[model samples]
Target chain A: MSDKLPRLEPAGLDGWIVRLFNDIDEANLSWLAALANRCRTAFGDALVDIVPSYTTLLITFDPLSLSPAEARDRLMVLLDDLEPDTSGVAGGQVHELPTWYDPSVGPDLERVAGQTGLTIEEVIQVHSGKSYRVFALGFAPGFAFMGLTDPGLDCPRLDTPRQRVPVGSVAIAARQTAAYPAATPGGWNLLGRTCARLFDRQREDLSLLKVGDEVRFVPVSREEFERQGGDITPLEERP
Target chain B: MTDTAIGVRVLRAGPLALLQDAGRFGVRHLGVTQGGPADLYSWAWANALAGNRWGAASLEVTVGGLELVAEKDLAFAIAGADLGATLDQRPVPLWERVVWKEGQVLRFASPVSGLRAYLSVRGGFAAEPVMGSVACVMREQLGGFDGLGSKLQTGDQLTVHPAGPSNNTATQQAPSGVRPDFSLEPVLSLLPGAQIAEFSGQSLYDAFNARWKVDERADRMGVRLTGPRLDCRVRSLISEGINLGSVQVPPDGQPIALLNDRQTIGGYPRLGALTPLSASRLAQCKPGQEVRLKATGSGAALQEYRAFRARIEDWV
Candidate 1:
């Protein structure tokens, strides 16, 4: 059964792909968390980066220091040392993010309600009810792909992507949810707004959400949102 | 100017200009793309000509139109594509070091040859490092002269302190052999990846045999090639870390060659990855320019890479 725990394959010159699972689920993420930890501990400086996504961990290394063959052998050895449960690495730091869930802030919130056949308040309640694990972070800096959102809130993306999605805009697409760390062209379904400064270059810890970190979204009032540097005005107020 | 004036000041900022070094490493896990010189070969040469070591930060000017005023007398080198560069309205030769007197103007006009030109100063450009690198990724807003990952704007001041005579490398000219002519079509080397077997046999054949035209919709993130639609049975998989030259195939079937400022992770199936040196060659390609891919074994690619590194060492 352990032999079927995915395999480490070579990726071009300076990277290795650790194919952990075929599907996205909690167990796969737990295994990924442990495997990523083991890779970091074993490879140390030789490892350039470990990109953890839904079911794969791509380990980029400095070829000048570590060869793919050696990296594969070491990783296999480390995998052997891990326990069967792999639950030791399951827990991660939980971060609570403050979000403004006004229909004005999230223009698509009403539309999502219409699609999911749930009340606006219920949508917000179910959305913020559970802790979401970050499956991956990409498309933009400090942008974490957190999921599997309440299946009830499942919604399709916009037919045509918006020219620009507001920064810190909390959005849901398919089963995953995220906040746009920076204003960029996005196609995700907008549901709310967050005042959390997801990324700050000045800080030693630049990104607010890491790959394995658990995230919880807490709703805030408009006054509280304004106080926390949210400068959004509703579309209806515009001329 | 202040009493201790250092480096050059932006006289005119062109379409796009950014400070780049080797790249930001060991941080992709945090969702940061590696920001570095798009044309690594040219960047290395510019640094070499400026008497700076490899991995030194240099100014990468895209589509030209950049002008700079030397605040202090310094030795600077221009390399990569010839962007109709001029010194005080006189033609300035590229791929060589030139002594820049105080207040002398160096201007780069529209591209006469290449899409990007590299300007390297002795002792490297002085920029505060973000996440251990001065490479500027505008999307990420990290690493640059301002440490905010901004492209060069007019009136932006860049700090540079030239090395003393003792530390300066005595070469003023880039060796003729390594200089690449950006005007010609490039045949890139592809290191076949795990997904290579997953693609259709005809698609694989077409990938190599067909000439992929560079689509206008290209940037630091990736270059979308308009050629054969590489059909693959596997559509999307679990997103994974993409490297500097990962050639990913989107649902549209067009291959987008990921570049220096590409996202940290991608879910699209990939045909393979371009060799590092091949990626540098592809960076010079302008919109509408055509390029082809040739499969290469890992051993052979490593040999070429090692040889290139050895050559750079010998140049120093």
Candidate 2:
């Protein structure tokens, strides 16, 4: 059955090809993750980096060390012997990030509430209600793309992106929620602010979360946020 | 052990001077960009001249104007660009070995030949490795002389491994060739990507025929080329992992040649990717330089790359 998985033509860039799965869902994500873990464990040094996205995983390797054809054959063998483990979910740390939902902290909270036709408090409630899964850490360093936000709170990104989004900012767009790891230009709809540093250069592990980590946001009062030393402002201001 | 300690004091820092080794590998999953010398050819040559192995940490001086005073006698070599260098106020040749005595000043004025220059000592620079590399990534703030990704500043001290047995004679044949004329028009070789057929016929014609101008909005991440707007039928698609030199054409039609500092993944529709050697050439090009893209198959591209690598192996 694994051998039957669709394999696309090689991308013109040397030693890379596209492997597409029919569908992407929670069940498939687990299968993909388990398969990736098994391949990494089995042929540890053969692979360079295996990045799992929302619907796909890109396994990049050293062309000089291992040819793409050989890598593809190895992947097929690992997938054939792999058993999907659905029970590996729900074991990540529950990080209670101190968020200040004030208008100053969240520049787009009012706009988001207006767009969704819900009160600001209702928007906050819908946002903090459920635990979101960390689909991947990409788009930028320490930027975690957590997902499956409440369908009611889904909002499209601003047509004109904010020139700069502050670090530790909690934002939502469509079905995804993310914490801005650093001050970078972003288009996501800002909902609140968090003091918990999502990325720190001083730490051994720079990113606070990984691809398979689980995340839950806990809203906090302005006083509590201040007490937690959350006064770090964006290095650059948004236009 | 006492004889190996060589020191240099920074008198002036160029636009950006950072200690770089080969690069940090096996950590992209952690969202770290491989921050090494923007020009690998020059970096490798500098190390080879110093009789050090590949991946040794060397000084990556960009847009020149860097000056250093030797605190002790040291043997060093300068490779890469002709960054008007002067040893004790006398013109010192580029891409050759040179000896400096204690208290001698080594100065690199504004770039006369190329954008970046590499200076390597007999012994590699003494810097603590961060994440198994001394390559500096300012954006990520990891890996440098201090392991903090900080650029060299005036008054900063650089420590090098103690001077080894002075092999003042050239051990390897000099790379003989005229410096690439950056002022001349550049022809970039590109390999057509998966979505080549997705582009409009007129766009494809223009892509191959038209001369594009390198836009000023260029950096380590990418260089945006301004030319005929290429219209693609595919407006949007799933974002996937992007490789080095991926030529992504957005809605605006201008093609962006992604480089080392590019994002890990992107969704933009791409025409194709420039070959590795072509990318190295493109890195040195200044803004407003005319560039024409030549379409070549992957097989030919790989063969050219192999030939270059083979030459490198001969030197090793």
Candidate 3:
């Protein structure tokens, strides 16, 4: 069992990269999360940063203060003491995002349906059915890559990605789905559009969701979206 | 406390300017970046000249074109780059301390020496710290004079504590000549990693022997180098955490040297990493500059690094 656990390798100059050999499954993610939380809670001062990804955690430290060998030894001790939490994330808030599946807003709905060999209605039904677990927030600020979608609707990414995907664009790639927090270039297939602002710079909390949060998209009518003060296009469209 | 102190009013803020201390560490899990002066050497010298303690917060000015007016009579030191700084219609010497009278204007033109400059006051700038640091990271929106990660702008009032007792002028002299001859090819030292065998022989030769050009698409996060394609036998691997100075070779075959603002994790295959000092030297290299990687033992690298740190400690 110990041999099956992830291994650590030298990263850049002053850090180490932990690699989990197993696939990105629930058990692996939970273990990774537990180890990360414990290590940070225990040695918060000595460690610079602990970045947890899909299957690994990167631990960085200041070489001037702490040597690489010392940091690795400490990490090894933490890993040995870590016990995988069985409760499956003690607390996670649920967020219901209102999404519109209109063709005009969802530019890649037909594309996703064509690739999945399912009707447009069937595509939307399968998408809105299951609740998604927020695996991580990365690539861009507030970009939440949720996971474990229904296998039936899973499809590959677009061959040539759109130069600029609109913000609030609900996208699907493989078994994962995400809401574009900000208008940026993306390759994911768009399935729907959302009026909810996933990221608000002015707001105290900035991000609508964080890692380990649960997300469920609720289908809404175009009128309801507009009534909710949804902009006709992104705020940056005029600019 | 002496009431006479030099204050500068922002006239034109360039791309980015922030109050930086050593950096806020031990907080990556909370999603905070370690923000510090881009050029640590110059920032240290500025503080040394002002007779301030190490880890003192100072202003890091990038790309020049920052204008400020002296609000009160104060002594300050400008170190690191020339930046074509002028005071009251007279050309001021770079990397030296000077007294500015109230209402005197200090202007910085385009970069004449280096990309970034450090300006230090006698007693470090008085700013409230966030999370045990005063360094500003815009992405995290944490740490700065206002603790909001907002860059200095026009009409913004900057407050500084009264200057303290000054020591005999700073002994460290700024290097003469233009910009440390960055045009010459840069030799970056790399310590091999665990996956050295994963790369092919040809790839290894090309990586160490070939000269790579700095790509224009470079930022604080990482600098991409364009050079001969290096092939790695290890095609797919588990995503792993990344570190500063990690040289990752993507599918495009170009090497990207991760820096201070890099992501916490990455998935690409890594050749190794540049030393911290090497990374700092590479940071000074402008785009289109040629760089070559030289593999060195970790023992030697660590010794050289400790010597460098000891020199900085002596000044303090």
Candidate 4:
């Protein structure tokens, strides 16, 4: 177990990046999550934030309370005795996001179809065909980075990111997919829009999707989208 | 608990004014970034000068043009960046506690020296906390005076918690030695990050010695530094959690130093990270201001930070 422990890289004066793996896989994410839990139990109030990304666990601690050497030593000890529980990750909850895939909301639907040499209908079918695992969440609140899209739907980011990718705009960059929890500048290829509130402060879990969850984009009608609380305000691409 | 709190009306909201505390902690896993005062030094000093405790909400006034009129007498302190503040047309001193009588106006003009100023009332401003914090993050639309992360606007009413009877004492002032002289270009201290060695030898040298100018592309999220193009072998990596002050160099070669409101993670190759105090110093710099970075070790950086925190912790 000690030999299998991930490498520790210095982030700064107060942070350490626990590199578990180099790729985004379910096993790596589960191990990172397990390590994150161990760190919290080990450090207690001394820890500031333990951010578990696809392949790394960035642990930040209170510099005042824990010195650099002390933090390293504790992490080493914790990792030596660690046993990752992959049970929860394998059986994680699946969330169905009702999506309205159309040119009205998904402006890049035609461009993506043209680039992929596939019909627009086929493109939508391919995207909605398989479920993606929620690898990580960042860039904005409740923005889940779901990944491993079908090879047929693989697309590059926009040459120039939009000034404002409207809220609920489901977009894809490379092999990853996510919905804009809020209106923000983004460079991902717009595929569709969803009405599900990805984030709400009033909810116990602020983010709708957590790491290790599965998400499927369920195609729906424009009227159904509106009925499900989707906003249909026309969006324009601005430089 | 229901006692009437003092009200402060915004006569002029200025460029950007938001309420901030230490910041929202223990919630980064939710993809939420910490939205604290860009200049922690000034915010802490202002709170200390007003005899307020740590985590007390303070107003961060940027590129000041804020004007306020209190409905009742209030005790407050202003610190960081000589913003040319005035009370009822009379000059208000910086780094010192002062009083604004009922109906008297307090105005902050454009920066005469610093880019941001902190205004902390004796009892701190009162607001409903969103996600256990009042630190306004406009990007996230969370945590502010209205608990909706809205910046101060003209005619907005701000509530201030009343100071206890114990706090009614003589005016306090921050020592002159402790105040930063924002006129001089800062030499920020950097701790070489994990990818420091990945850069070419020349790029590494230029990173430390080059005079980087503060680019106009700056905000609470991050500040871009324009200088020599720092070429790195690695174009990108697995996106990892980005800490405050992480100086990541994109393909364009310019380094963007992540700040308080930066995204939770990034994949660009990082040259290094600025110390927290250095980040606070850089936050006060105006656009096009020349600055340099000096490499430092974690031990020395921690020592300096601990000393600064100790000094503030000693304050009431």
List, in the given order, the native-contact fraction of each candidate: 0.68, 0.35, 0.49, 0.75
lDDT of 4 by residue, B1-316 (tens): 2453757999999989999999998889889999999999899999988889888999999999999998898888999888899999999999988987889999999889979999998888998889889999998989998888899999998888878764525648887688999998799999888788889999999998999999999999999999899999889988989998999999999999999999998899998889999999999999989999999988999998998888887787
| lDDT of each candidate versus the true structure | 0.85, 0.75, 0.73, 0.89
Query: What DockQ, between 0 and 1, does each candidate earn?
Result: 0.59, 0.39, 0.33, 0.61
Label model 1 with its docking quality class: medium
Pick the DockQ winner: 4
After superposing candidate 1 on the true structure, give the runs of residues whose Cα lies further than 4 Å from its correct spot. A1-5, A84-91, A227-229, A235-239, B1-5, B166-169
Better of 1 and 2 by DockQ: 1
Indicate the residue-level lDDT of B19 in model 2.
92
Instruction: Give the higher-DockQ candidate: 1 or 4.
Output: 4
Interface RMSD of 2: 3.6
TM-score pick, better of 1 and 4: 4
Ranking by DockQ: 4, 1, 2, 3
Model 1 has a DockQ score of: 0.59
TM-score for candidate 3 = 0.83
Error of 1 at B197 (Å): 1.5
Q: What's the true lDDT of residue A81 in model 3?
A: 64
Q: Which digits, one per residue and each the tens of the lDDT, describe model 2 over residues B122-240?
A: 68788878877888877777787777779998998988876456443545435775235655677888878767788999999999999999999998788999999999987655556
* Model 2 Cα shift for residue B255 (angstroms): 0.9
Pairs with backbone N, CA or C atoms under 3 Å apart (clashes), candidate 4: none
Ten residues in sequence with the least summed lDDT for candidate 3 chain B: B172-181
